[model samples]
Target chain A: MAGTWIFVEQRDGNIRKVTYEMLSEAKKFGDEVAAVVFGKGVEALAPEFAKYGADKVYVVEDDVFANYNTGAYVAQMVAMINEFKPNAVLFAHTFNGRDFGSRLAQKLQLGLATDAIAVELSAGKGLFTRAIYAGKALAKVEVAGEPVLGTIRPGVCEVGDVSGAGAVVKPAVAATAADVYQTVKSFVPTVSARPELTEADVVVSGGRGCKGPDGIKLVEQLADLLGAAVGGSRASIDSGWLGHELQVGQTGKVVNPNLYVAAGISGAIQHLAGMSSSKFIAAINTDTEAPIFNVSDFGVVADLFKVIPTLVSELKK
Target chain B: MKVLVCVKQTFDTEAKIELKDGKIADAGINLIINPYDEVAVEGAIQLKEKGVAKEIVVVAAGSDKAMDAIRTALAMGADRGVLVQQDTAADEFARAVALADAIKAENPDIVLAGHVAADDGSSQVPTRVAEILGFPHINVITSIEVAGGKATCSSEADGGTQVTEVSLPAVISSQVSWNEPRYPSMKGIMAAKKKPVATVAAAAADNKVKIVEFSMPPAKAAGIKIEDEPEVCATKLAEWMKNTVKVELK
Candidate 1:
């Protein structure tokens, strides 16, 4: 019988939404779904996994996993995989997931497909589809090795109905301090109530046309009114108008939100690669020739400084 | 400190990709060192200049043409180059194994690589190599400082920055913000010719994954355009977003 394992990612004791997203996707592979969580005080989050379709939750609670270290996490995951021998392992394509999952796949010599947008069972094996050339093309990949590993791109799959058995178990393997060679000195979190850009339901992004940081403020206000996450194009980030973490483009974060709004941004191909998969796109730019209008569901030719305030006010009413 | 930088040759970022018969058509296309990898090479050069690194070696796993990319790194001031001869079809796992094998022989103090290859965007090979070598790995590092045999760096995370310190012999993937890569000058180009580039046979390994097919994304339909006063445009956009896009507006 085939078994599927999903890495349940958590931070500061709260579970991330992508874990459930992966669980929902894992259920479709016709395998016994398991969720593996590694962290201190994460056992309480097991019931939440059950709601998302986990047949069993494997909790590796230890102080050694309190902080996210690639070496320690990979060691623990490798140990768990060796014991369980799951046919497939799923992870969210987040920073930590990419770090540890890729390493685990390498240490075990397993077939790994990263940033997969779609996963399905074909011919009794898993087929993963990923984007290449900045979302211009899709490549379907099939894993030939046992225990195939994949990292699912966040916001691509939907959360399925809750109908799991809610069973939870503790894994025997434990991570030791010696397993870690790196130490996290500090975490400086961005103080924002807005949802993370990658997982946001809506994203509002500005480009060079924002003119300066002040103009980006206007974009932020519009995003706030719409309850959306704020992002910037490569031009804006390169100009220091925004932080690199907020950049959305080929070299930046890929977002597949339900709605995306672009203001004063001429959609470069690189920028389009990151947000083209969004369910709905709205573009606002003064230049009618801007390529962003080509993919937008709705387009407006206007000055963003004037348009943003108007949108914010209109939404207020 | 001995530092090894892994680089890849990829199409220029601005190159318009064309596919023919389910593969990228490369004729007449310009190839450059993967931009992020260039940043890594630059970082190593900076470290060497700062007297923190004693030597820098660049490595790549690709066909013979990858030497051009290595030469570019050597021009940027890497000491030597190693090319692991392999077919372009090798998957990330196989590439990592080959690279680990090459890297293990050097026994360097550190390994540097691009956060992700511009072509495939896998972001896997370096991390996999670190795992195979049992070394600590960090990705998307913005700044790195080596002192007292430990490297402390700030890396980008989901909602913020993470300040981390890893022991020597760690693998770090360079972010674009790490450092600006220097351009190869005429003098540097001449010197690069004298740099040694050793080609090594790559050990064959089983590929875990196979690309079944490749196809272009569907064309997007033309959108509705609105040209009106700012107020009118805002009202219309809000209406479309609510009625058509059906987004929940707070």
Candidate 2:
């Protein structure tokens, strides 16, 4: 019987939503699903995993695991994989997940697929589908080696509740301090009530045509009105009009939301690769010739400064 | 300190991608240094200008055309270049293995690369290489400061910036905000021709992952276009959202 493992990512003991999504997806493979949670005070979150089809929960709690240190996390993960001997491992394609997942694949000499939108078992092997060429194309990949590793893009898979055996297993791995070669000096979290760009169902994005920070504020205002996430194109990011975390492009976060609104954004191919998969796309641009209109479900040719304020008022009414 | 920067040649960001027979059609396509890698190169150059580095070496694994990108790096002030000639079919794992072998030979104090290749969008090769070499890596670094054999960096995370400090001999993948790259001047271009770019055969490495097939995403169908006054367009959009998209509006 195949065994599947999900790396349950958490911060300050709060489990990330993607972990539940991965757990739910892993159960569909008809394999015994186990969740590996590594952080101080994470054992309390095991019941949450069990609610999402995790048959067993492995907890590695230590002070060194309090922060995200690459060496520490990879070492523990490698140890866990070796002991569990799972045929497949899944992770969320977040900053920490991508970093640790890629390293784990190398350390174990296993096949890895990152940012996968879908995964299926074919011929007794895991097949992954991921976007390539800046979202212009999709590639189906087959992992050749054992212990297939894949990172699922956030918000791609649906989260479901499937109860499983609420068994907890504490794997006896060496309790050594994480061999951190780096130090995390500090972190400045963005204070916002809006949804995360990658996880939001509705996203409102702006581009160079936003002109400046004031224009981005308008975009934010609309997002606030709709209770949506705010994102920016590469041009806006490069111009320092938005934070890097808000960038949505080929090189940035790939978001597939229920609704995507592009305001003052002339769609570059790089930008299109990130949001083209969104269910409903609406483009607002002054330039009629902007390439974004080609793929938008609704196109409005007008000044965004005038259009956005009017839209906000209309939504209010 | 010696710095090694890994760069890749990719299609221009604005170029329209066309696929023919399940493969990218690259004929007559304009290729430039990957934008993020250019930022990495600029980071290395800034370190050199700050007297933190004795030399900077730029490396890539690609065909002869990739040499142009290496020369571009040299013109932008890299000391030398190395090209690992390999087939384009190599997956990210194989490429990372080949690059790790080459990087181990150089033994530089620090290694730099882009967070992700715009063409493939895998964002795995550099991290894989770092793991293979047993080196700690930090990705999406927005800014870096080197002093006293330790580097302090600010990297982008989900809705936050992580300030990290790592010792020398580590690998860092740069984000777009790291630094602005300089263009090649006439003198720099002429000098770049004189700089040595050594070509070596890529090491034979097994591909752990293979792409079985490639196809373009389904084309989005044409939608409604409204060229009217702002108020009318706004009302139309609101109505469409309420009726068609059915999104929750508070």
Candidate 3:
């Protein structure tokens, strides 16, 4: 029972890619790596977890899990943790995951590290590293005399394929649904054909220099051309030119993409903290002294409006 | 309805980090209300202005300096304030316990806090308080409306927004830009001085997550800047992206 458990997050019955990444990483740190998934119509996904090295897939299928509810999910997870008594329980650092992860830790009276970018095995315990000061510094975290519980940040771990024969285990959850305290009024899923901002390899963004919504459209065109995601600086978001979901900053979504192209954004410390970890950065702005150039691998100090079309056409080369 | 807003004082988002003896140097640093917590305060003020909320009580746990933030929130429209005196060195678990105890004494109808602390980046305290109080929580919320003893909230979720309704005595954490925070006018600032802010000792709670040390990330190297014509720059950039970066450009 002292194995590792990774909470699998799913949307529309499709397993989020981050789950596979976490499961694959968990294999190296635990004797047995298992994935616990809660949702309706997810039994077919148990086999998919095996490909990522999960020895067993713990499935909790019910109508109450049709969508994420804090009360319903936390109650079931507490029961499972108590029954299995796993040494390590990892959760994806998504919205729902972060919300309930702390709750579970409190209910179980365990210690937890939030948004850990890396984890290692320390005497069969977890050594978690997370960012603090809005990514200005790194904090090495250890929960003293407690089981390792943490929310794993996305885009850091490598995906592994141990090829374990996925054994599906539908553990009997003694927790009843009567404790649920929420009612879903409506769930308007954001419908966008573009790749998700966090998972996309390329993310093109604009800032205050975009001046208005029209400039962001050009940035979107470039993102669409590259099959990338569109994002904006806090300045652009504050102007109401873009939705909060598309904001990339300390207070918004932290993205670690392969290529991040920033147009017109004078890289503030807040904006850089979110995308500074990007593998390769390119910036286009008129100011040669712009801070964005410090982190960019490539820089073009020219008018973004003048350069975007030419860059688009040249990429068409 | 009684509203409780949990606030935290953090370094100004624009402040430069300086480490002395492996700890952040607080001297000469400008401290302000966390931008996200300010959003929570603003959300509460809006609810009161709409006639939906009757009174708002702001609370914080820290050294006496935190009283400044509580005063700021009061000026913005909190009815009264409570300061739970404690060293801020404690982890989210300890902080949540202290805040929850203070909250229990009041037994508010609703609780609001920032989704995450701007300093530790731990998005835990608010939801942890929700658990300690046995209240349902909806976090990372962009908008929240309360009526008929229920809170309707729009939260930012994985793929999109999820609108949920939780009964009274629930927890809600506000996201940045949910609403523009108001400045403390001179008149409001004067009023805040007259407002009663009580101080209470924090109940002892254990520190679960201890930080071994803090180190600044390595500074990025200076990069090459091409200030040539648009056409030439574009051509060179496209070559670098394809050949150097190896990004598959469609």
Model-by-model DockQ, in order: 0.77, 0.76, 0.78
State the lDDT of candidate 1 residue by residue for A161-182, as single tens digits. Answer: 8557758878775579988888
Error of 1 at B51 (Å): 0.7
lDDT of 1 by residue, B144-244 (tens): 99999899999888788898998888999988778889999888999999999999988788688889998777888888989888889988998887788
lDDT of 2 by residue, B114-200 (tens): 999988888899899998888878889999889888889999887688999987788999998777899989999999999999999
Model 1: interface root-mean-square deviation in Å: 1.3
Off by over 4 Å in 3: none
Ranking by lDDT: 2, 1, 3
Q: How close is chain A of candidate 1 to the true chain A, as a TM-score?
A: 0.96
lDDT of 2 at B23: 81
Best by TM-score: 3
lDDT of 3 by residue, B1-250 (tens): 8899999999988777778898878899899999899999999999999998899999999999999999999999899999999987978899999999999999999899999988889899998999999998888889988988899999887778889899999999998857889998999999999999999999899888778777787777876789999788888888888888787755
True contacts kept of each: 0.80, 0.81, 0.82
- Sequence-dependent TM-score of model 2: 0.96
> Which rank order by DockQ, best down to worst?
3, 1, 2
RMSD (Cα, Å) for all candidates, in order, is: 1.6, 1.7, 1.4
Error of 1 at A133 (Å): 2.2
